[model samples]
Target: MSIELNEADLVSVSVGGAIAHPGFPGLPAEPYRLAADGTPFLLPTFGGIVYNVSVGDRAFGWAADCIHPGVSIKGADDLKNRGLNVFSCLGNTAVVMTGQAQGAKGVVTGKSGRFSEQVIVHFPVEVRRKMAVGDQIVVRALGTGMEIRGHAAVACKGLSPSLLKALPKKVEDGVLKIGVVATVPAHLVGAGAGLTSEGGSLHIQTTDRAEVEKAGLSSLRLGDVVAIENTDSRYNHGYLRGALGIGIVGQTDGPRAGYGPGLTVIMTAPKGELGSFAAPGTNIATLLALEP
Candidate 1:
């Protein structure tokens, strides 16, 4: 047996939803949800901006000595395990303290956490730098991973335009089930899922009929973990497909053709696997010959 990596960094970036501050203008809705109340938030998106890094960049995703090596923190190694990072706050109503506009607080939007010494808050750049590094950030984590129960990442190997084309056209609708949780938009599938050898599952696809036809899986990258399962599984049930044996997620040219906004399970599963995390009908507990 091998030893599991148990190194939970001393400090993890806190994340939360944004809540509209009192008397805040614009869309009069609660942007800062309970996550602003100081709860645990998980899953940071790739190439997303936190304190300094811009959206769609991986400058600060790793648990390294220097977290956000650009804007927030000057030196990455210096801020390895410090007191705290302001970006830790995920979603909450926040007041801009420093920079050009001071005291002008806005609802703390989504937080970019996970090993970032410099936290990422989703606020207008003009007013994001309320607190500097080591400042207090708030967040409220709700529910649990169970919220996405009975789901799995679609795994693949040696991803390429050709590999994606090889996927089953339709396995007879009732044969397979797919689970799509926290799905990202299919139209925006370019590079959203990296082509790493991890788990190799692609668990999501485009519901936009037109996009699926022209784009197909060609837009998807290798090692992309797409979610798939059966219908009637839950909120993400219809997302799970039983048609093509395991459902359709990536580039395909077959009978199944309805793609929708879905989650990118690429990170959850291991490298070079076919499918990770079984869907609703999948014998979750039952051992399978294909499991890694």
Candidate 2:
């Protein structure tokens, strides 16, 4: 199915500077463990160019709570309230309007709001080098009133028509089955909790080596679509048994005690409202035909 957007759906935002990673505040004598040699360290978070990573890479990084290739609109409250964050769909064009990279173009990879609302974009390493914080970037926000035909219960958020078209879907026994790489339990969810799904993401806890191995969280890669069980992310994230949240793995976190890969919500619904089948190839890279 095809959806159209009008002029009113578009909005623009300024690219803000990278957010420095503040070590766990208030922790006694080094909040967490250091390297094997007892050297102190902290993981990179928001802002700046992430040269070594891209859209389809694994989410595991050496830096804790790291957010790659961060780009945000300063004072995003107005845009967020008006659905800029919600409608700035993935695969949307992001054009650099200032700095050395002026006129450079990139693609919106995902949306996140761990500390504040921001849109994560992917640009070439060389272009990223010339980009600076506070650069002007424009996005054509377009994902509103999106729906899955014959499935009114399923709610679509932060998804672009281009992204939707790339996804593979089918009807199975009267249930709309979307392809996903894995299904994660709600109990394993961390960070970005108590946050509205408007423009945010939740972390998949991977601190415990045993739990990480058991849940297969370690194998998760960026862009993979995973089913989150027993959670409602329509408006706000909450415990709702039987609810399911289908999201894309957006960002990788360092081996923080409680943080791991981040899940950016794409579609969500109440219990028994939607179903999914394990399909490993159902990822942003595969759907959009981007280099893996």
Candidate 3:
């Protein structure tokens, strides 16, 4: 299916072009980084909310702590038509209102943010520097896909806030951090490959085995928001070709051989911030109360 923005991609944002919001902070004057390699790049964000598993259900070794940030830009009225919008929470309004992407425009498709950060806005390779964690871009909220897909959306056709609210609530970390969590040991993390729920499980990758042990594998339940660190991460974007969430797991082609693990971020703290808990094997540096 060749994706194209029809009316579905055309959320007007403003009722008739009056400007939906004054907007959060506009695009940054200078983004910290851009895709030097220049593949079909996407900024990672939290995939949105899910529920904690129960006796019949299980995280099944997935990153059971946090919500994957949606691949959002800013808010627009007709983004729902473009097949890009997904809504969850009263804060869905806050998402489009937060950064440089706010009021601006882009496609909010991939739900990233498990261990990754950045709202995973898929740009045309020209707009990378225009956005950053602090910068606000514009997003067109689209509708939800299917529940089996495990994503967030406002569209009545698929996963919506009701579905998001209805999930199990597997884990709870009262705090929410902004940036990615530190890496954990490869051995200690539970289980997640490159794809599941279209790569929704990407956030569980970690580089700290000790943190895994300390966090207590059993202590981890689905839907918990854990943080992660931003490293080379050994991830590949091509895996996402016609695929979503592939970047989260760093799935190049086969099984991840080196440091390919995911983490559940608790929240979004400010940049240069630290986490609040110290797991056994990871080097998170500090434990902070975060909000993302």
By lDDT, the best candidate is: 2
Candidate 2 structure quality by residue, lDDT tens digits, 1-292: 2333332444433333231222245746655545324556665665545666777777775454556543444333554433546666777777777779888777777776564456777777677667676676776556666666567888887777678667766676666667888888788888777788877678787766677778766777788888888889888887799889888888886555446677888888896777788887577877776532
Q: List, residue by residue over 1-292, the lDDT tens digit for candidate 3.
A: 1111232342334211111111223586432222223323222212222122211122234442222222333223344312222232111222334444444343322333222222333332233333443344443333223222211211122122322332222222432112221233223333433422222224342334455456444343222323333311123211211111101122111122222233312121222222233333221111111121
- Stretches of candidate 3 above 4 Å error? 1-57, 61-201, 205-211, 229-271, 274-292
Give me the overall lDDT of model 3.
0.27
Better of 2 and 3 by lDDT: 2
> Cα lDDT of all candidates, in order?
0.26, 0.69, 0.27
**Best TM-score goes to which candidate?**
2
Ranking by TM-score: 2, 1, 3
Q: Write one digit per residue (lDDT tens) for candidate 1, span 181-268.
A: 1223333332223332211113233334464446333343211223432221211222223311122222211111221222212112
Report per-prediction Cα RMSD to one decimal.
Answer: 18.3, 4.4, 18.5
